[model samples]
Target: MNLYLLRHTQPDVAPGICYGQTDLGLAASFDAELQRIRAGLAEVHVDHVHSSPLQRCQRLAAALAAGKVHQDPRLMELDFGEWELQLWETIPRGLVEVWTEDYVQHAPPGGESFFDLQQRAISFFDEVSANNEDLLVVTHAGVIRALLAHALNMQLLDAFRLRVDYGSLSQLELQDGRVTVSAVNRRF
Candidate 1:
């Protein structure tokens, strides 16, 4: 089984802003980036295409799947809750510190913890992985990192160290009963 993870292209928002599950649109560079992503994936044989319902990912997924995408809420970005559209600098320093200290188990006010996101993401992954078909998931950085962490049994904190850049591609392959990470943050 081949699992391909692709993060959405740049969003049409300023840097330093917190946006998770906020449903933002793509940036002006989306066209070029999308073209690059399409070119990069031209060689893969995708049997299934799943994507987050957010516009950023939906657009890309639709393009890749030729409008035959399966939208899954579980693939959405982490719910930032009250911090959804707020600038990171504007969020309370104390709250930020607390969440950053142990984001895996700590939930932002009204939001879920990284562990919660992982549970949902893994559930979706497991369900689809049972088919043993090649999959293309257009999702967020958080979900990709969580999947990578789960596959490698790495410390949750260490997953944060893996940078999932916009429009980057990562892959996992399952052979026999073992899963191996074949790529991480690969750009065209």
Candidate 2:
């Protein structure tokens, strides 16, 4: 099975703000971003295409999938609940410190833990792998990180060390219950 994990195009949100699972719009570069995405997919075809329900990802998936797409909530970014839209620096510094110390287990005031996100991603992967066919998923960066962590067998905290930029595609190969990363952050 091959997985093509694509992060959504740049979101229309303020920089330095925490907008996890907020359902934001794409930046003004939609045309250019779509072009790049098309260029990357010019040589690859997948059995199916899936996308997070959030508009940021859905918009891109809709364009790429040509009206046939599967929308899944499990592919959403980490839920930051109360932290959504709040500037990172404005969050209580002490709380940030505590969360940083054990981010894998720590959930924001009303959010979820990285472990939780990873579990959902693994579940989604499980479902997608059942067909043993190529799949393209347009989702958020957090979801990409979670999927990458599972594919690479890295700790949730260690997953943070990997940087997944917007409009990037990472490929993974799954066989005999093991995963191998074929590429990371491949952008056009």
Instruction: Please give the clash total of every predicted structure, in order.
Output: 0, 0
Cα lDDT tens digits for candidate 1, 1-188: 99999999999999999989898998899999989999999999989899999999999999999547999999999998999999999999999999999999998898999999999999998898888999999999999999999999898878899999999999999888788999999999
The Cα local distance difference test for each model comes to 0.94, 0.89
Clashing pairs in 1: none
Give RMSD (Å) of candidate 1 vs. truth: 0.9
Cα deviation at 18, candidate 2, in Å, is 0.8
TM-scores, all models, native as reference? 0.98, 0.96
Overall local distance difference test of candidate 1: 0.94
RMSD of each: 0.9, 1.0
lDDT of 1 at 21: 89
How displaced is residue 79 in candidate 1, in Å? 0.5
